[model samples]
Target chain A: MKTKFTRPERRLLAASCAVPITAALCTNAGAMHIMEGFLPQGHAIAWGAVCLPFVVWGLIAMRKIVAQHRKAVLLLAMMGAYAFVLSALKRPSVTGSSSHPTGTGLGAVLFGPAPMAVLGMIVLLFQAILLAHGGLTTLGANTFSMAIAGPFVSFGVYRLCRKLKVNRLVSVGIACALGDLFTYCITAAQLALAHPGEQGVLASMAEFLGVFALTQIPLAIVEGILSAIVLMMLESFAKPELREIGFLQKEVVKA
Target chain B: MSKKQVVTILILVLLCAAILIFPLMTIRDSEFGGADGQAEEVIAQIDPDYTPWAENILEPPGGETESLLFCLQTALGAIVIGFGFGYLVARKKYRAEEAV
Candidate 1:
């Protein structure tokens, strides 16, 4: 394979690879996104199986993206990195689940949901193995919530807002925020289903939902605004790239 | 620069302030737990006999250390991904301009 990487690119790659290896060597704590060994074997496997098709589809979609728009490969990789960084910046939440923005909202808005599945899964995998955050067993459940469900909702909501003629910034904000909230809701439901309390699955789900809402709601709003800001920055600085990606129509830019 | 941009920024700042303030006001005495920890507690309360089917392959020496490692890992990942993406996009632009 004739590969071309400049000196700076090689340096960047070297530094990036070194950081993870050093961090992995230093820590054993194994942080939690649903925690390690939190789920029963059966539930874990089931969720993993459920996620299989989406992942496969995402891989195919990613392949197509690379084939069709070679330039987008970088954007996709950046989106994955953005998600990892955003989600890892854990904030305290009332539900006791360390909360962070999923970053899928912005991704979905820019690249749509299917590709997000691939990007999200990659981010989760890195977090699991390198940082000891989120475990192998729970990868499926986490992937579903953060990657699949959240991005889909973001895409749906963004499109709906656009249809309703909402202001572009406002629509992006609402979509991203709602997307973050929905990720948590799905996560809570997953937990409730796995270990329903005396009140049954629905009641337990409600409990989880209520607890997460205390922190997640605010976090979602913040994420929404952040995503909107990011979008605006991209519009101003990366307008050609955005136009090429179909995120910003040429007519809209001209107008 | 634009009015809308200013409004967006203001909303973001206010929301951030609210997030910080609301927690302080309501949970002054409580130790806020992560969702994973709280979920475990809830499961135990709901079903006393419930046992985790698995355990972490490795346990860190301390919570703070674990957090440190996580931050480091994320920072590294961000740097790499950011650089790679930037390089690719810039390369594409350069190539296009050369052809033009």
Candidate 2:
């Protein structure tokens, strides 16, 4: 089964796998920080409103997918559980705000964004009830930002890189940056909505970019590096592991 | 992509761009986001002595459950419960379909 690949083919294969895998790992890096009541109330409510339709769509999609495979239900449920638990273990940051990784990106990359949304909603619900990291009223908002938007950004970045025929390392680096930054942008938007008396969208965006830049930019880069590293490791050592996680399939290679 | 799809994507992108630039579209830092009457009122009702008590306990010493452990346990429990329920429902449905 070991087909000898030419150098160009090897590079292409590596690029195809690394790009998406890098994004997936970056998503995983943020896996559980979706705390409730963190954003302004209005922001949370607004996002929640946005999330409702998505939830319905997501549930329909998931039911179809899960019916095809019962194990998918187990995986999604485990993912939600993972998010809830990781969120609860947050340490206090210098800003005096406790933060956790949402990890939605990671799960989304493994499964898909639609399933992740459903799973994320479940996690957010549990986080609110058990740990009080977020609130019941704000669950939809948190889910939209952390679950929906975050994964879209990660998945989008991966697909964009693939379309561009970008190099593996650089694609991963860029994808991670976008994935993390997308979450921050969503957070800023949510914050702006919930709180009143902001200067404007531009000003708030600037403020968020400015404040989060110092931390988020560096964090994004770090995540990118970690994701690249993980992809490389997966590529070289444990490719079968990637297959198990749905990163690769025998059919994709034949195509 | 189709012509209609192209238009849809353009509109969606433009809308997000608009929201990204405007903070007031989201609201501003007011009572909800600030230290104002709402916080005071909620605090007073929830725990009147919270201010002084917070000062004393801002940094608790020794022997506390880390947040990570707590999150893990919670997630594990949720997964077990959720899967258990989902499995039961799916199994029942599958059986019903078979019977029919």
Candidate 3:
């Protein structure tokens, strides 16, 4: 860290963080991706099949990162833990609408979308089995939306912003926010397809979108800002690790 | 933490508070519910006959148990990130001293 925190300062930081976390605990676990056994059998199987290739790719990518970068092992663990923390912290928003942040965006930005596939799959698996939240049957569909779709969006936004030479934090924030928004969009689409409304699939999608997208906008921004703060912390204390991981090239992050 | 980072973090805390509280203030008679359930409601609206056939092999006993498991997930996550960060910071600090 650039500065060592005093006892009081640490307390203040913890107190500030405690507010949202405590609120999260009080809220119902409602905003998780398509719940247990929600999808029809064929749709469920299809979604799972679709996610198979990505999960395999992610396993390979993660193994490569672990085998190649001993120093970066800690970074990898931090990223996984970060995804666990954020997804578990569901935020309630406007008009009693509640949703959760997919912390995968930060990992996608730091590493790449590929490794996030494995981490996200594991998180969803645990949520399904232990919490009885998002179901095992719908795992494939949920994984596709939260893991593959979200991370890809984040990685794309991040790469685009970096290519444009935008400020580092801005890149991280925009990428993560958009990535978070996209996850729900896919979820809405998945639900729409499974149960098309009277008007049609498009109408059904719009209905699902209406429920999720509006509330997600602000939550997405919140995820973005929080992610940028984490990146800032990493840069301060884990400069060597970041550099070794090729996240901070000689002038890439320099203002 | 550095002054800039601390300030940024505090701003985040305040912003999150606003996001959570604004709805309660503006919208009345709102049942703050989960989006997943809302989506399911939409599904029911579309296909009234359809019922979710698959079941969780191990359902958490109740909402409380579910909450407990969620909290456990959070705790495990916190510990991993905390230990990873502490180790990295300590390695940097002590390694700097050794180089000096």
The TM-scores of all predictions, comma-separated, are: 0.79, 0.54, 0.87
lDDT of 2 by residue, A106-221 (tens): 44554556666777777766555554444565566667777788767876786577568776545655665566557656655554443323355556445544443333443444
Which lDDT tens digits does candidate 1 get at residues B28-94? 6656656556666777777677776665555556888788877875786589666865664465566
Candidate 2, B53: how far from true, in Å? 22
**CAPRI grade of model 1:** acceptable
Q: Name the 10 consecutive residues with the lowest summed lDDT in model 2 chain B.
A: B51-60
- Local accuracy of candidate 1 as per-residue lDDT tens digits, A1-255: 012345664565455345334443322222126666677666676666556555655665666668766766767776777787788877765433456778888888888887787788777777676555677778878888889899989989988888787888789989999999998898888888887867899998887777665568878887888788767655544655666677778337534
Off by over 4 Å in 2: A1-45, A70-98, A166-177, A196-198, A209-213, A222-247, A250-255, B1-100
lDDT of 3 at A70: 75
Ranking by DockQ: 3, 1, 2
Candidate with better TM-score, 1 vs 2: 1
**DockQ (CA atoms), all models:** 0.32, 0.06, 0.53
In candidate 3, stretches whose alpha carbon ends up further than 4 angstroms from where it belongs are A1-32, A250-255, B97-100
Compute the TM-score of each model's chain A versus the native chain A and list the values. 0.81, 0.64, 0.85
TM-score (chain B) of candidate 1: 0.62
Model 1: share of real contacts kept: 0.40
Ranking by TM-score: 3, 1, 2
